[model samples]
Each structure stands twice: as C-alpha cells, then as structure tokens.
Target: MQDVIIVGGSFAGLTAAMQLGRARRKVTVFDTGLNRNRYADHAHNIFGHDGTPPGELLAAARQQVQAYPTVQLVPAKAQLVSGGPDDFRVTTTDGETVSGRRLILSYGIVDDFPAIPGFAQCWGKTVIHCPFCHGYEVAGTRWGLVYSSPMSLHGAVLYANWTDDITLFLDGHAIIDEERHKLEKRGVRLVDGKLRTISHDAGRIASVTMDDGTEIALEALYAHPRNRPSADLHEQLELDMGDTPTGTMIKAGDMQATSRPGIYVAGDLATGMHSVTFASNTGSLAAMGALQSMLV
Candidate 1:
C-alpha cells in the first residue's frame, strides 16, 4: 500500500505530494487533467510566478514532484473509492486498484454557469470570477456583476477596490431600495430584468443582452455561480460536507483533515477563498497532518 493516495493532481494534490515526497513517503496522485483554472489565461496574484498560465505552473510543479521517485502521478480519474483511513482503496475506471494508508480529496470544483448565451465560452476571459485574481489587469475597465445572491451585494461594494465603473445586473434577483441606494451611492448602475445573453468575441465581452432587448456594453462580466465538487469521491466515501458563500465544499478542520479520519481535503473543495496561494497552504497543512498521523 502507498503512503497516500491523492484523488486529484492539481495544485493542492501536487503540493501535498511534494511535501509527502520530501518526507520519503510513497504517494500516488490520480488526475483527470482538468483543473478548475485550466481555462484561465494568466494566473495572477501567485507569488514569484505572478501572471504565469495555470497549466504551466502546474506542469512545472508536477515535474518537480515526480523527481522525488516515491511519488507517481496517474493520469486517470479515480472511478471508485472504497475502504477508509489506513486501509483505503481506490480504483480507476479501467479497474486498476491501489491502496494507501491516507487519502487526500482535492478534486476541486465545477462552476454552474447560467444559461446565458456566450457566457460559458467567455469564462476565464471577458466573463470571469474573483476580481482579486483577474482584476488588476482590467482595472478601470467597464465591469458588470451578474447578481446571483445577496452576497453579490458584497461583491458590488468590494469591486470599488478595482474599478468605479460598475454595473450590477439584477438578473431577476430582487433588491430593496436601501440596497439600491447603497449601490448607487457607490456609483454602481443597477440593470433590471432577467439576462437574455452575453455577446462576446472569442471570450472577450462585447455586451450583455437583456430579456427586454436592452444591451449594456461591458469589458468584463463577473459572476459567482454556485460550485460543487467535480467528483463524487467525497460523497461515495460519506465525508461530511460544508457550505461556501458561492457553493458547497468538503468540511475541513485543523491540518485540513476531513470529517473522516485519514481523509484530508484541501484547495477549492475545502474552502471558499479560492486562490492558488490558499491551495498551496492548505495542501501543505494536509500533507503535514497526514504525515503526523502516520507516526507510530
């Protein structure tokens, strides 16, 4: 049995592997090669490698981690996860099986895009999320926020950190006059009616078309679609779930340990504050926790 079987091989998984690898522990990472930020062009706010493509950063990390000899990155989805804690077993779709003493579930999440035309295509480009991650580049450009919940009001206010030219699309969500006044006071324009579609040129926003046929020109449209784990390993394992501001996540605690002992979780699956830095930090924590748990 391997020392650890990490269910995902993206930032969190790779980071965890590196730590465990340094400790001379056997680690196997299963990956489907689809990272949440794979669509993003340049990953910002990442220290040292600021503005590097997400894929490139991960590629370099994988290369470094694999050099440890004790770690293997398997390019396959973990089809079935059975057993638990020190006797955990994982099977790939092709029926290959591997058992590890500990598990790390960092499969990440998937964004639930609205049915607005041209929206999903523009993800990671003109239409985006996380202003702190993509904002500096577009600061001073026309920005639009697709209101999803009351939490969006917080986004509208927080966005002043980047740009003042902001429009909060009602998108069929109701807002009280007090909220509207506060938005207006911040120089935010409120667009009424449900969204019809988004017009874009190769992921570059052109304008947002409304149900009433009104069109608002925008450079970037920010959306907070609810997110969920990209895989079902957590559920199949019956790990406890948690809620984030924008969606559901796997509940994690000290050292990034999950509700199930020997099952550690990190990155977007375990936290709402999604970012590369946070992913790396949590990943190291989980690795240390798992390593310590393995002590006799």
Candidate 2:
C-alpha cells in the first residue's frame, strides 16, 4: 500500500505529494487534468511567478514533485473512495484500484458559467470572477456585473472599489429593494432587463444584448457562476459539506482533516477564494497532518 494517495494532481495535490515524498513517504497522485483555471490566459498576484500561465505553473509543480522517487503521478480520475482511517481504497476511471495509508483529496471545483452566448468564450478574459485575479487588467474600464445570485451584488460592490465605471444588470433575477437602493446610491448603474446574449468579437466581449434588443457596451464583466465539487464521491464518503459564498465546500478542521477520519480535503473542494497559493499551502498542511498521525 502507498503511504498516501492524493486525488487531483493540481496545485494542492502536487504540493502535498512533494511534502510526503521528501519525508520518504510513498505517494500516488491521481488526476484528470481538468483544473478550474484552464481558461485563464495567465495568473496574476502569485509571488515570484507573476503573470505566469497557470498550466505552466502546474507543469513545473508536477516536475518538482516527481523528482522524488517515492512520488508517482498517475493520470486518471478518482471515481470511488472507500474504506477509512489509516487504510483507504481509491478506484479510478481506468478501473484501477489503489490502497493507501492516508488519503488527501485535492480535488477542485467545477465552474458552471451562465448559458449565454459568448459568456464562456470571454471567461477569464473580458469576463472574470475574482477581482484579485483579473481586476488590474480592466481597472477604470467599462465593467459590468451580471447578477445570477445574491452574491452577484457583492461582486458588483467589490468591483466598484477598483473601477468607477461599473454597471449592475439584474438579468431577470430578483434583487431586494434595500439592496437595489444601496447599489444605486453607491453609483452603480442599475439596469433592469433580461440578458438575451453576450456579443463578442474573436474571444473579446464587446457588449451585452438585452431582451429589448439594446446593447450595453462593456469592456469587462464580472459574474458569480455556480460551482460544483470535483467529486460526487464525497457523498459516499459521508463528509460534512457546508455552504459557502461560492458554493458548498466540504467542512474540515485546521489540518484539512474532514469529519471522516482518514479522508482529507484540500484546494477548492475544501474552501472558496480559490487561489494557487492557498491550495498549495493547504495541501502541505494536510500532508504534514497525515504524516504526524502515521508516526503516532
């Protein structure tokens, strides 16, 4: 049996595997290669590697982890997780089953963008979710906020701090009266209409089309897309999930230990504010926790 089996070989999984391997622990990392930030052209605000493409960063992480002979990186989606405590069993998409003394779930979340024309095409470019990720590029530009949930307003308010040119689109969603008034008072232009589609040119969004056939020019847009966890196996594992501003994240303790004894969650699957740095840090913590438990 491996010392640890890490599901989802993204930033978090790779970091955890690196820590465990350096400590002379055998580790296996399973991944499907569907990282949430694949659409981003480049990642910002990461120290030492500012403006680096996310794919490149992950590639370098994988290379660094594999330098230790104890770590094995496998390309497969973990489909089933069973057993518990210091002993766990993981089955992957390829029907391969592996057992480990400890399990680290670095599985990320899936982003479900709005079903509007050009929305996905412009995502991570002219359209983004996190202000810290894409705010500086479009600072002071004609930015628009499309409301899909109550959190959309919060995103609008936050984006306004970065740019004076901000517009809020109700997008056929109900907004509370007090919230509407507050938004207007804060200089956020409130537009009441259904968004029919997004018009774009060659992956760059130009404007949003309303149901009334009116086009609102937008240099950039912000949205809060619904997020789903990377694995449905969490339900089978009987882990406690809690609602977050982004979506449901598996509730865990300080060491990334879930209520389930041997099952640990890391990265976006455990919490929101999904960033490379946080995920990597959590992964290392999870690995250290598992290592300490093994020693005991």
Candidate 3:
C-alpha cells in the first residue's frame, strides 16, 4: 500500500504530493485534470507567479513534483473511496483499485453557471466572480453586479474600490429600504428587472438587457454562483460537511484534518476563500498532517 493517495491534481493536489514526496513517502495522485481556474485566462494575486496562465502554473508544478522518486501521478478520476485509516481503498473510474494508508481530498468545487446568453461565454473574462482576481485590469471601467443572494451585497461594496461606476442588477429580487439606503450611500445604482440576455462582442460584455427591454451598457459583470464539490466521493465516505457563503465544504481542523481520521481535505473543497495561493497552502498543511499521522 502507498503512504497516501491524493485525489485531484490541480493546485491543492500537486502541492500535497510535493510535501510527502520530499519526505520520501510513497504517494499516488489521481487527477481528472479539471481545475476550477481552467476557465480563467490568467491567474492574479498569486505572489511571484502573478499574471501566469492557470494551466502554465499547474504544468510547472507537475513537472517539479515528478523529480521526487516516491511521487506517482496518474491521469484518472477517483470513482469511490472506502475502508479506514491505514487500510483505505480507492477505486478509479477505470475499475482499478488502489490501497493507501491515508487519503487527501483536494478535488475543487464545480461552478453552477447561470443560464444567460453570453454569460458563460464571457466567464473568466468580462464576467467574473472575485474582484481581487480580475478587478485591477478593469479598474475605472463600467462594472455590473449580478445579484445572486444577499451575500452579494458585500461584493458590490467591495467592487467599488476598483470602480465607482457600479450598478447592481437585482434580477427580480426585491430589495428592502435598508439595503437600498446602504447601496445608495455607496453611490451604487440599483436596477430592478428580470435579466433577459447579456449582449457581448467576442466574449466581452457590451450591455445587459432586461426582460422589459431596458439595456444597460457595461464593461464587466460580477457574479457569485453556487458550487458543489467536483467529485461525489465525499458522500460515499460520509465525511462531515460545513456550509459556506458560496456552498458546502468539508469540515477540516487546523491541520487540515477532516472529522474522519486519515482523511484530509484542502482547497475550495474545504474553504470559501478560493485562491491559488490559499489552495497551495492548505495542500501543504494537509500533507504534513497525513505524514504526522503515519509516523505516529
């Protein structure tokens, strides 16, 4: 049996492998090759590697981790997880079973895109979620906030730091007087109507159209859609889950240890602050936790 089996080979998974690999711990990483930031053109806010393409960053990471003799990378999906500490069994989608002493779940979450024309097309470009990731480029440009929930109100205020020309699209949701006063105080324009379509030019948004034939010109749109874990192994393993403002995530402790022994979780699957740097940090911590467990 290997020392550990890490599912998902994106930022979190590769970082975890790097940690255990350095310690000469036998580790096998199963990756379906789907990363949450794959849609993004370039990753920002990541120190040292800012402005690099997500694919390029991960490619470099994969190459570096291969130097360790104990690390093995497999291009496959982990179908199911069973067994317990030091005796866990992982079955791949191809029907191959692998046994490991510990398991690290770094599979990121899947985004639930809105069913709006040009919305998906503009995603990762003109339409984005986090301002910290894409706000700088479009600073001082016309910005629109597509309200998904009350939680989005905070995003509207935050985006103001990048641009004062901000408009909040209610999208048929009723806004109370208090919320309206707060938004008005921030110099945010509130638009109330059902969104019909987003007109764009080559994946770049030009205007947001409402069902009532109202058109609002915009350069960029911000939205926070609900997401779920990329894989369903958590259900099979019966791991404890916690709710975040965005979606459900595995509950992990300070060491990235899940409620279930020998199972550690990292990345977007465990926290709401989704970023490449944070994911890498959690992956390192989870790997260290796994190593300590094995040593004990």
Candidate 4:
C-alpha cells in the first residue's frame, strides 16, 4: 500500500505529494487537469513567481515532484473514496482501486457561472473574482461589481483600494439603506435590476446588459459566484463539512486533519481564502501531519 493517496493534483495535491516524496514516502496523485484558474492568462501575487502562467507553474511543479522515485502521478479522476483511517481505498475513473494509509483531499471547487451570455467567455479577462489576482492590470479604469451576496457589499470597499470609479450592481438583491448610503458617500454608483447579458469582443467585456435592456459600459466586472467542491469524493468519504461565504468546504484542523482519522484536506477544499501560496502551505501541513501520524 502507498503511504498516501492524494486526490486533485492541481495545487494542493501536488504540493502534498512533493512534501511526502521528499521524506521518501510512497505517494500517488490523481489529476484530471481541470484547474479553476485555467481561464486566467497569468497568475499574480505569488512571490518570486508572480505573473507566471498558471499552467506553467503547475507543470514545472509536477515535473519536479515526479523526480522522486517514491512519487507517482496519475492522470485520472478519483471517482470514489472508501475505507477509513490507515486503510483508505480510492477508486478512480480507470476502474482501478488504490489503497493508502493516509488520504489527502486537495480537489478544488467549481464556480457556478451565471447564465448571462459572454460571462464565461470573459471570466478571467474582463470578469474576475479576486481583485488581488487581477486588480492591478485594470486599475484606474471603469470597474463594476455584481452584488452576489451580503459578503459582496465589501467588494466596493476592497475595489476602492485599486480604483475610485466603481459601480455596484444590486442584481435583484436588496441593500440596506445604511450600507447603501455609505457606498454612495464613497462615490460608488449603485445600479439595480438583474443582469441579462455581458457583451464582449474576443473575450474582453465591453458592456453588461440588464434584464430591462439597460446597457452599462465597463472595463472590468467583479463577481463572487457560489461554488461547490469540484468532485463529490468528499461526500463519498462522508467527511465533515462547513459552509463559507461563497460555498462549502471540507472541515480540517490546524494540521489539515479532517474529523475522520487518517484523512486530511488542504488548499481551497479546506479554506475560503485561496491563493497558490496558501495551497502549497496547507499541502505541506497535510503531508507533515500524515507523516507524523504514521510514526505512531
């Protein structure tokens, strides 16, 4: 049996495998290669490697990790997870089963895109979620915010750091008078009504059309759509879960240990705040936790 089997090889899984590999522990990583950031042209805010293409960074990391003889990287989707503790069993899309003493769930989340046309097309370019990820590129330009949840009210506050020209689309969600007045005082233009479409040229957004056919031109639009775990393997394992502002995540402790023994979680699957640095950090923690447990 392998020392550890990690699901989701994008960021967290790969990092976990690297840590375990360095310690000469046998590790297997399953990846389907569908990264959430695949739509983004370049990733930012990562120290030293900032502005690197997301795919390039992952590819390099995968190559380096595979250099370890104890590490095996498989290009397959983990379909089901069973067993528990030091005897966890994982069945993949290959119809083959792999067992390991410890399990690390690093599968990321999936964003539920809006039905608005051109939204997905412009997702990473003109339509974005994290300002820290794509803010600097469009700073000092016409910016728009789609109020998806109460948590979104603070988006204008955050955007104010990068640009003064900001418009918040209530999009059928009610805003309290107090908060509304605060936004107005901050020079934020608030627009009501739901979004019907996003007009773009070559994946660059030009304007957003409201349900009533009102068109608002914008350089960039920010949205926080609800997301769920990319795969249901966590559910199949029946690990404890918790809800975040945007969606749900698997529950893990300080060491990345799930409520269930021998099972760990890391990266976006365990935290609401996502970044490449955070993913690698949590992955290392999960690996160390599992490694330390094996000694007992």
Candidate 5:
C-alpha cells in the first residue's frame, strides 16, 4: 500500500506529493490532466512565477516532485474511492486499484459556463471570475459583472477598486431597491436583462447582447458561475460537504483534514478562494495533516 494517494495532479495535488516525497513516503498522484486554468493564457498573483503560463508552472512542479523516487504521477482519473482509514482503496479509470494509508482530494471543481455564445471562448481572457486574479490586467477598462447569484453583488462592489466604468447585468435576477441604490451609489450602472450573447473578437470580448436587443460594449466581463467537484468520489466516500458561492466543497479543518478520518482535501475543492497560491498552500497543509496522522 502507498503512504498516500492523491486524486489530482494540478497545483494542490503536486504540492501534496512534494511534501510526502520529501519525507520519503511512497505516494501516487492520479491526474486527469484537466486543470481549471487551462484556458488562461497566463497566471498572475502567484509570487516568483507571476505572468507564467499555468501549464508551465504545473510542469515545473511535476518535475520537482519527480526528483523523489517515492513519488509517482499517473495520468488517469480516479473512478471510485472505498475502504476506510489506513486502508483506503481507489479504483482508477484504467481498471487498476491503488490502496493507500491516506487520501488527499484535490480534484478541483468544474465551472458551469453560461449558455451564452462566445462566453466560453472569452473565459480566462476577456471574461474572468476573481478580481484579484485578473482585475489589474484590465484596470480602467470597461467592465461588466454578469450577475449569477445574489452573492455576485459583493463582487460588483469589490470590482469598483479596479475600474469605475462597471455595469452589473442582472441576468433575470431581481434586485431589491436597497441593493440597487447601494450599487448605483458606487457609480455602478445596473442593467436588468438576460444575456443573450457575448460578442467577441478572437476570444476577446467586445460587447454583450441582451435578449431585449440591448447591446453593451465591454472590454471585459466578470462572472462567478456555479461549479461542482470534478470527481464524483466525494459522494461515494460520503465525505462531509459545505457550500460555497461557486460550488460545494469538502469541509476541512485547519490542517486540511476532512471530517472523515484518513481523508483530507485541498485546493478549490475545500475553499472558496480559488487561486494557485492558496491551492498549493492548502496542499502542503494537507500533507502535513496526513503525515501527522500516520506518525501517530
């Protein structure tokens, strides 16, 4: 049995593997190779590797983790998880079964893209989610906040720091007068209409078209779409879950330990703040938690 089996190979999974590998613990990482940031041209806000392509950073991490003989990275998806503490079993897509003393879930989440035309093409480019991640890059540009939920009101207010030219697209959601006044008080333009299409020039948004034939020019649009865990193992394992504005995540403690023993979670799967740095940090903490459990 391996010391640990991590079900994801992006930022969080790789970081967990590195921590275990450095301690000479046998660990295996199963990755489907689909990272959430794959569409992003470059990753920002990550120290020491700011502006680096997301793929490049992950490649470097894979290489670093491979230096230890105890670690192995497998390009496969985890199909199911079973067993219990110190004897967990993971079945992969390739008809193979791997057992480990601990399991780290960093499979990440899948963004539920809106059905609007050109939205997917512009995602991670002229369309974004986090202001801190891509805000500065489009500072002073015409910005639009496509409201997905009431939680998005917080995003509209936070975005004011990056640009004053902000428009909030209600997208079929009703807003109370109090909230409307609050947004308008901050110089944010409010538009109550369902988005019909996003017109972009080569994956860079130029404008958004509403169902009522209203067209609003935009340099960039921000949206927080609901997401679900990439892997379905959470249900099979019966791990405790919590809800985030974007999706349902595994509930982990300070050390990234899930309510279930021998299972830990990290990355976007465990928190609302989705960033490369936070993912890596949580992975490290999950490793420490797993190690502590094993040592005791």
Candidate 6:
C-alpha cells in the first residue's frame, strides 16, 4: 500500500505530494484536472507568479512533483471510496483500485452559475468572482452584482471600492429595507425583477437583460455561486463534516486530519474561504501531517 493517497491533483494535492516525497514516503495523487479556475485566463493576487495562467501554474507544479522519485501522479477521477482508518481504498473512474495507509482529500469545490443565458459563457471573463483575484483588472468599469443571497451585499460593497459604477440586481430576491437604504447611500443602483439573460461579445458581457424588457448596460457582472465539493466520497466513508457560517466542510484538525483515522482533507473541501494560495499551503500541511502520523 502507498504511504498516502492524495485525492485531487490540483494545487493542494501536488503540494502535499511534494512534502511527503521529500520525506521518502510513497505518495499517489489522483486528479481529474477540472479545477474551478481552469476557465480563468490569468490568475491574479497570487504573489511571485502574478498574472500566470492556471494551467501554467499546475504544469510547473506537476513538473516539480515529478522531480521526486517517491511520488506518483495519476490523472483520474475518484469514483468510489471505501475502507478507512489506516487501510483506506479508492477506485478511480478508469476502474483502477488504490489502497493507502493514509488518505488526503484535496478535491476542490464545484460551482454552478445562474441560468442566465450568457452568464455561464462569461465566467472567468467579464462575469467573475473574488475581488482580490480579478478586481483590479476591471477597476472603475461599469460593474453589476447578481444577488443570490443576503450575504452577496457584502461582495457588492467590496466591489464598490474598485468601481463607482456599481448596480445590484435583486434577481427576484427581496432586498431588505435597511440594506436598500445603505446601497442607495453608497450610490449603488438597485434593479429588481427576474433576470432574463446577459448579452456579450467574445466572452465579454456587455449588458444584462431583465424580464421587464429592460437592458442595463454593463461591463462586468459579479456573482456568488453555490459551491459543492467535487467528490462525494465522504458519504461512502461516513466521515464527520463540520458546520461553518457559509456551509458544511469536511471535519479536519490543525494538520488536516479527518475524524476517521488516517484520513485527511485539504483545500476548499476542508476550508471555507477558497484561495489558490490557501489550497497550496493546506495541501502541503496535510501531506506532512500524514507522513508524521505514519511514523508514529
């Protein structure tokens, strides 16, 4: 059996593999390679490699991990997960079964965008998320926020710092009276009604169409998507999940160990805030933790 089986070979999984490989522990990383940011043209806010494409970063990371002889990288989705607690097993989509003394799940989250026609097509482009990641590029442009939850107001406020031309689309959701006042005070226009669609050219959103046959000219739109963890392997393993203000996450400790013995989690699955840097760090931490646990 491998010393550790790291599910998901994105930033987090690779980071973990590097740490374990350096320690002379055998590691296998399984990845489907559908990272959420795959569509983004250039990743921002990440130091040292600012403006790098997500693919480039991953390719470089894969090369570095390959430099370690003890680490094995497998490009396949985890289809089934079974066993547990120092003797866990996982089956990949291609029907390959793998067993390990420890499991580190760095599988990222899944994002579903609004059904608005052009919205999905514009993702990672004119329509986006994460101000710190993409805010500066479109700063001071005509910006719109599609309200999906009450918490989305917080995103809108942050976007305002980068652009004065900001509008909040209720999108058939109720906007609290007090919140409405605050939005107006900040010069954020309020649009109410069901969103019909978005219009764009070459991946750039140009306007937002409402159900009332009114179109709001816009340069970029912000949305908060409902994200679900990619692998449901947790259900098969019956692992404990912790509650967070936003949603539920795989239960893990300071070192990323799960409640089940020898099971660990990293990246978005184990944490709330999603950042590329955070995922990379957590992956490495989980790898080191698993290696240490094996020694004991």
TM-score of each: 0.98, 0.96, 0.98, 0.98, 0.99, 0.96
- Tell me the number of clashing residue pairs for each predicted model: 0, 0, 0, 0, 0, 0
Q: List, residue by residue over 1-296, the lDDT tens digit for candidate 4.
A: 99999999988889899999999999989999988899999999987889999999999999999999999999999998899777889999889899999999998999999888899899998899899999999999999999988878888988999999999999999988999999999999999999999999988989999988899999999988899999998888788999999999999986999988999999999998988889989999999999999999
Model 4 lDDT at residue 236: 83
Candidate lDDT values, in order = 0.92, 0.88, 0.93, 0.92, 0.93, 0.87
For candidate 5, the 10 contiguous residues with the lowest summed lDDT are 148-157
Off by over 4 Å in 4: none
| Model 1 spans with C-alpha error above 4 angstroms | none
- Which one is best on lDDT? 5
What CA RMSD would you report for each candidate?
0.9, 1.2, 0.9, 0.8, 0.8, 1.5
lDDT of 5 by residue, 154-183 (tens): 888888899999999999999999999998
Compose the digit string of candidate 2's lDDT tens values, residues 127-227.
88878988898898899988867777787788877898899988887777999899889899988888888889876889999989989999898887889
Worst 10 residues of 3 by lDDT: 147-156
| Error in Å for residue 59 of model 4 | 0.7
Model 2 segments beyond 4 Å from truth? none
Which portions of model 3 show Cα errors greater than 4 Å?
A: none
- For candidate 2, the per-residue lDDT at 89 reads 91
Say what the RMSD of model 3 is: 0.9
> Any idea how many clashes model 1 has?
0
What is candidate 1's lDDT per residue for 1-50, written digit by digit as tens?
Answer: 99999988998999999999999999999999999998898999988999
Q: Which pairs clash in model 3?
A: none
Please, what are the lDDT tens digits per residue for candidate 6 over residues 50-98?
A: 9999999999999999999989999988889888667788899899998
